[model samples]
Target: MRSETREASKNVLGSPLRACCHNPQTGYFRDGYCRASEGDMGRHIVCAEMTDDFLAFTKSQGNDLSTPNPDYNFPGLRAGDRWCLCARRWQEAWKHNRAPKVVLEACHESTLEIIPLSVLKQFAIQAMN
Candidate 1:
């Protein structure tokens, strides 16, 4: 059986939502949606509010999230930007105290499988009410 995280059929807690602004490239499928499917192994499920510190830290770890790369269709990232990030990567950042804030409405519930809800709640920016 597939993991619950891998079986997320819709955006967490809401309808299909746009996780990122597409002026530049974003999203696992590059469709600007954070929805996951059977083919998505990295589990790009968290809609994180990008920050300079997290971006720089990710870059230092060799991900280079800030540099635009045409070959991979990556238009690059910037502070205050929104993007779908892998659950594992986000949790890893949290482990190191580099995890950025998150948009709860945009974040996939699959994230809860890897990270605690209370932890995510601590970084939440979007209001549920």
Candidate 2:
């Protein structure tokens, strides 16, 4: 279900959440923004840049993100493509040291509920630079 009071869409930094990607039309709502509301069981709110290792890791877990799914209209992910990932999935990948870089400005603040800001900072794309 949804939160009693809808929170303003913001990022982990408490700023307005930016679009994660429009190319693949990411997001649980397929609106290119990392957000979640009622019925979003997966909580796809983490803006993560795809990587081969991460893709392989997810595929091994039975979620083959790299393979296109025509039924879902998914174009399949590849290294460098940004997508709205599940917060718990990113945490799992982080535990395995296979997590991809995150775009903090695009990651929904709700992600902080599953992944600490510090841990997310460790994998921040801006931090890598």
Candidate topping TM-score: 2
Record all residue pairs in model 2 with backbone atoms less than 3 Å apart, i.e. clashing.
none
lDDT of each model, Cα atoms only? 0.73, 0.87
As for model 1, its CA RMSD to the true structure in angstroms is 3.8
TM-score, every prediction? 0.81, 0.91
- Cα miss at 54, model 1 (Å)? 0.2
Enumerate clash totals for all models, in the order shown.
0, 0
Cα lDDT tens digits, model 1, 1-119, are 24333234444555444355455545667766566655789888788888999998888887888998889877788998888898898998999999999877666666677888789
Most lDDT-accurate candidate: 2
Candidate 2 per-residue lDDT over residues 32-85, each given as its tens digit: 888877678999989999999999999999899999999999999999999999
Error of 2 at 84 (Å): 0.5
